[model samples]
Target chain A: MDVKPARRTDSHFVASLEKAMRVLEAFGPEQARLGLTELSIETGLDRSSVQRLTTTLHQLGYLDKDATTKRFSPSIRMTELANRYLWSDDLVKSAMPRLIDLRQALGETINFSRLDGTDIVYTARLPSSRTSYAAMIIGRRVPALNTSSGRVMLALREPGERQRAIEEWPMQRFTSQTTMDREAVKRLVEEAAETGYSIAENELQMNELALAVAVNRNGEPGGAIHCSVSGTVWTRERLREDVMPRLRDVANAIG
Target chain B: MDVKPARRTDSHFVASLEKAMRVLEAFGPEQARLGLTELSIETGLDRSSVQRLTTTLHQLGYLDKDATTKRFSPSIRMTELANRYLWSDDLVKSAMPRLIDLRQALGETINFSRLDGTDIVYTARLPSSRTSYAAMIIGRRVPALNTSSGRVMLALREPGERQRAIEEWPMQRFTSQTTMDREAVKRLVEEAAETGYSIAENELQMNELALAVAVNRNGEPGGAIHCSVSGTVWTRERLREDVMPRLRDVANAIG
Candidate 1:
């Protein structure tokens, strides 16, 4: 998912947060440093507004101003904030060893993602380290239904969950092969649950094939973990015969 | 440093970002799955605010909501943001290999940082792989005068430049070793420029000895690179004699 945050709460304070986000977004792939005038121009706010925000931010550790140069730059407060967000999650870190093992054993990109309402969001990833995917960056999020990882996660959701997701938002196809019909998605969820695994071939149209399984922790469905491979590797029969058992074993081990 | 940005830009926006941050933060070392009301209680935000923020965040890739259960959880957007940050600096990435090589040869925590006005922001770090230091999270920023890295960068600043930083904000005594006199600090900067490096012992009170060299690029001192050893490891003399050459070489290579 391009890592854009969803819309914000309409609290009286939302505008301030939006402004702050604009300032943060203002510093991107380029333009790492700014003077107050530069930030105001970039953010489309008056200098007074930018100055007020920056002053508070500087005090709080988000932005640091050079005492001599009068230039402003980001501070370690960004990491501190990110850590406050989800850095404390052991689940993501806990999956590291197994993710490393899965990457080595399967030679495919591996991911661990959790369910967010109807969609799935990845929390941990071990790129096919020896031969990186060259496609996925570590933290990008994708649809829960379109990916093998998503399908595996969706399978574990309670029965009405499938209908709700489809109802809440009709499937938006990620690729030509992505399923859009509610009935088809429902069937996929059901079958995958019964089989204890999910497989998708050329569905993501990265032309990747994937096998996925879910983790059960303390009787709760944790999330899905999947192994993905490019087109050259997949044959349907191989997925069923060669990959499914090992995928199941990995799931069991995590459970 | 914490991975999350705690101090976002304007205080007005603090609520929005904090709410969004809290929604992600809601998933902690534990408590991965949280129903809307539960989320409200956990964050001390109202149910409606929590619900709205969670819904928007879900759409934006930061949060995932389970439709059937109406619970909220963290999405992979956290990792995506982290990776986005890691790759933000092309210059730092290119310098990483040489930085690592120098760290190993020097047997100290080697670091490179850019001057962001008054603060020295660390863009790259090669910690002693064989040992651990206090805190060395990449993207962390530190005070310029308080650190050898900062002092080295400050040494290259023009007379007006160094004068401005001190005048804008008088130096605060961060540690027993921090020099409080502006005139004294200025003289030290002059000495550092003449000698081509700066050294500080127990300056930040970590009881460490450090040496730093400024990387002058295009007739401007762009940044500083430093190597540090614990007082427990290198006697002041050994550090002065043994470590200075490696630091100079590393800085030269960087320039």
Candidate 2:
């Protein structure tokens, strides 16, 4: 006889609350606004549930309904919640000054990111004096295997978790330099763990170079500080030999 | 015979959704993380309901639980949602480049804000090169009556709504220059409506000066863009003669 493991459900979890949050999550950068039907389809909730959740969210100041289009989009109050985190969250507060200094030292865009499941989300960004093709918006999400920050963060995870992620994460080829094979990706992650830093050259975008070092709080990886520059400005040797030290220093200060 | 007006409740409104959102709102900069009992007290929900809602929120990735203390806090996913608004929302996307230009032109901080209830929330902020004591984090909330952006946005509201807001808004004195008298605030808002601009000097902060103009989309107020500088650097005369026109031009470009 074959048996399957039972699913676990915490008795305290509210089903309605999860459904309501799912409704809000259905709206994103591509779909900034959605009508009730679209929301229903995206969240896999019925029309009545979507209507009820969206209406309640509107009343709570999270969703704004356009009168003409009759579509719901995130309201400004949503920003307030995030702003509170950026302002008061310990990790951001600790890293911001150092991140600014890193930007000044490298004359390149500086980013701070944290792992969110299999993706990395930019928590803060300081733009370079010179504009680049990369649009560094805070809260931007990218795949965990195609960026330096992701590799550093992934390497910092527990051994079992890192192995699971390496096996499960979808390795999409973003550019010619992108590594899709699991073994190559695993090698990169292991190298990051050994060297205390990670580098990505033209992995996510053409002619873009990024280096990242893990930030630790209480001796555990909290996030990462990364420096991104143009390939024309810094060759691979210079980034590894010259920039890596400064990045590690900044990470140490922040950690 | 006695008659009472009926309460407005859209048929699709969900009470659970509202309660869950309130739990999220209860965590602010002051209370960046909260325990279940504290959340219950702050949101005025029962402990069990707070637990259920917070648990569900944790599962949905909007909240994170601290392993040691079991406290709940807003997670990075919250920033992702807000970031989508800042990146993709029409008003913010249009105003940002102009706001950046305005910041460069005056060498002062520039802000984009919208009215939320009787308060104004900063939706985007571009800081000046020289930092000031004033904290200008995006999504910071302040009373509508005490800010130039607030006055400009309030002036753009429909007459009845504007009048109601003028009468109902809580007028608090931040600095001595804050307009606490309702009649005086109304006069200032009326003047802003007439001249297409607004100014607040030493109102919200003792040494800060701000000027604002409304941004319109489809011929109605979408939000307001404002410039802020130190009172020592700019007098009222200079603000009106040098800054107001440029601010108006930027607002027009954005609108």
Candidate 3:
């Protein structure tokens, strides 16, 4: 296993807390329940430490252990924290009603996502009635370069940070239509900035087309408001003519 | 100031990690964006420890510091964890579509909540068109004795634990109709268990009536599924005739 980064020696840094967070981070969309050995490998913590930390977390009502599986998963208490965290964001709170309105008006999924790390996390989502996919779930994260929301927010980032982010993120091709070429993606970001909106056509998934516009607060881009349409029904021309204007109107209203 | 509980002497328990969680817990519906002194007081940590923990949390992107106010709030990164945490619950994942269906049918706000501590935190919610209250926000906690969901879950708890919980929780009067009598609240819980459902009329709020049925998984009440209607619109007879059967049907289907 690859060795994890050495803990920061900064006096104020609580190593134990960081380690605990690392344990929590080890669980994701795929690895929901994990055993001690798996968690040890994932978090790069020793088995005993993982056991201790998981036990402590379980005792605190943050982690639940399945008696049959002998694996641990985050308990419902974490949902409380997640709910508070989303509502605490002023930008998210203000955009919610408007996002709901747009979802009703368009009959498509509506999302409000903010850039965090090299990804965009959906802070709020109103799923389309026809959607079978759970893509619009609040808190689901997608790659920064792969999503229209990410590209829209990345396009608005300060030049130096944007360049660093572009270089840092891996441009993996998710589908046949996904542009893995760095220069092509850079052009897409630039075009999005110039046009005040961005679109990703079957980049993340073969049957999805997403378009986004950045929501600004006091001239600073806070996040992106976006809508995803099923590619089976939506073409680029139709998306631009039908969905883009309403999306932009909502973003502008939020800004 | 009241003294905080002493840290467990167990070698496996990570004291610093627990302290950090306490800091996170300190920020709630009321106490968002707390300063160093306020956090110290809230967490019952010395100023220096609070400073170090908050600084570390800020650096890790879990907490964000406002440059002008010097107060810290949860950053967007925290939302990532929150998303993963909610998705980790099997009960929540299975109930989502059914909850959506019930919300549409009843045209009233639907909520799924689980008993946590002396409160019930909303695990999932689908708001009705006419709903204006944000009380159903996922993770929003309400008194277990005051809501139908809470009563349903509490009714199923071990008698000793339920009694202890009732003693522990502060039965604050939220409305004139809220029953503050402990014996009366216990009787409501007992009635819920006998009837296989629960109701709260003008309890938490003056004009809101809530009905709930336990989402049983393997005969154990896993959580409660509930719907709230404006008392102005929903009479007890209509609630029983129209909403109760549908609520019980969804709960049974999920179970």
* lDDT leader: 3
Model 2 / residue B44 / CA error / Å: 1.6
Could you give the candidate ranking by DockQ, starting with the highest? Answer: 3, 2, 1
- Ordered by TM-score, highest first, the candidates read 3, 2, 1
lDDT of 2 by residue, B24-103 (tens): 77887678889998998998899988878887777667888999999988888777777766755677776666665666
RMSD of 2: 4.6
TM-score of chain A of each: 0.70, 0.87, 0.91
Query: What is the CAPRI rating of model 2's predicted complex?
Result: acceptable
Write model 2 residue lDDT over A1-255, tens digit each, in one string: 011122126676677777776777787777888999999999889998888888777766788899999999888777777875675568777666666566555657778898877788887766553433134456777888877898998887788888999999866787887978889889999999898899898888788888899987775678988888888878878988888898888788878
- True interface contacts reproduced, per candidate: 0.20, 0.58, 0.53
Output the better candidate (1/3) by lDDT.
3
Candidate 1: tens digits of C-alpha lDDT, residues B32-129 = 66888788887888988887677666655456667798776665445445444444544554556666566546646777777765677665544443
Scored against the native two-chain complex, candidate 1 gets a DockQ of: 0.15
What Cα-based lDDT does every candidate model obtain?
Answer: 0.63, 0.77, 0.79
Q: Write the per-residue lDDT of candidate 3 for residues A1-255, one digit (tens) a residue.
A: 112255377777787778788898888878989999999999989999898899888877788899999999987777767765765787777677677677667767778888777778887766654444356356777788888888888888787877787778856677898877777778888898899899898887788888899987775678998888998988888988888898888788878
Candidate topping TM-score = 3
TM-score of each: 0.51, 0.86, 0.90
Candidate 3 colliding pairs: none
